[model samples]
Target: MNSELEALNSLIMTEADGLLYEKGLIRKLEKYGDVFISGSYFLQLMTWRDLDIYLASDKMNEETFFELGKEVSLCIKPAKMNYRNEFIGHTEHLPKGYYWGCYADFNTNAWKVDVWAISSKEFEQKQQEIEKLKFQINVVQRMAILKLKNSVYNHPLYRKKFFSVDIYNAVIEDNVNSEEKFKYWLQIKRGLSLN
Candidate 1:
């Protein structure tokens, strides 16, 4: 990662440890399975961005799942909260998984936190796929992915249309640069739905 991203991540980590963990929010969610953090904030080699926290648990039910979501929302006191499931439709290009998530902003920090719940099976499968792709992604390919994601001025429309997974696929499998990948993204972006 670059210096800016590293510094931002360090500060975010400190806040998560001091505020979230100390407030018992992180501890309360420990029963949800091995927590894994993803998204641009953690992976991209660019400027700082939001956080994506996924809890892999097989015990999620309709009642407790939404209840846990409410708990997380209340604990974080985010500025916005949308607890919705986007996998019900648009199954073609979307990732194969069952999840309930909240997209929220805590303050005016140019960053947000997305807390979500996904099944253990789906989580494991996605992790394995990412692990296999990690070895194939060298510095050049990683830069390509980062550049493509940053091309859209970090717009929500761009992220929904051409997510990190889409960028990874284009960079690794198609071996396309940022421009080509972006053109392809524009071609298919309209068909996708925001989660």
Candidate 2:
């Protein structure tokens, strides 16, 4: 791992720890269901202050989920919280569950926390995908991913025109090793031109 990437990841992890444990976010979440941290944080490829948390429950209803949201609001005092009931109206490329998109200031940094309430089955399915990526990622690919992620973290097209999965695929599957190569890959594969 690049020394710079390692240091940046460490700083982000420390902030994440403060948010999860010190802020009692995880404790509050566990009261509702089994909480599983995922995404960049779990993959240890964090380039920004974002957290993906999933609450697995065999039985979860809207009322209970709202109650959970209420508790989360009181705990985190988020700047804004967006709710999505995907279970009722599932969206493409999204899980079928309740979601809370929490935007908050933690440790003097703005953080985006995605909290999902899904069935254990759904959680398991997602975990399988993450594990596959985890297994396929070698040190070289990890560094490539980290570099590409860092390069695009603040780009105009970061999450709007492209996403982390595209970066991962470019590096892991298409062998994209630099920002220049990633730009070309995006243009060829997704017809997206950054410039």
Best by lDDT: 2
TM per candidate comes to 0.69, 0.94
Best by TM-score: 2
Candidate 2 is scored at a TM of: 0.94
Q: What's the lDDT of the predicted structure labeled candidate 2?
A: 0.92
Give, for candidate 2, the lowest lDDT window spanning 10 residues.
86-95
**For residues 52-126, could you state the per-residue lDDT of candidate 1 as single tens digits?**
667787676657767776677677665566555544553565443334344444334544566656778777765
What is the clash tally of candidate 2? 0
Per-model lDDT: 0.60, 0.92
Q: How many residue pairs clash in each candidate at the backbone level? A: 0, 0
- Residue-wise lDDT of candidate 2 within 1-195, one digit each (tens)? 499998999899999999999989999999988898998988999999999999998789999989999999998889999999997777787899999999999878999999999999999988888888888899999999999999889998888889999998999898999999999999999999999
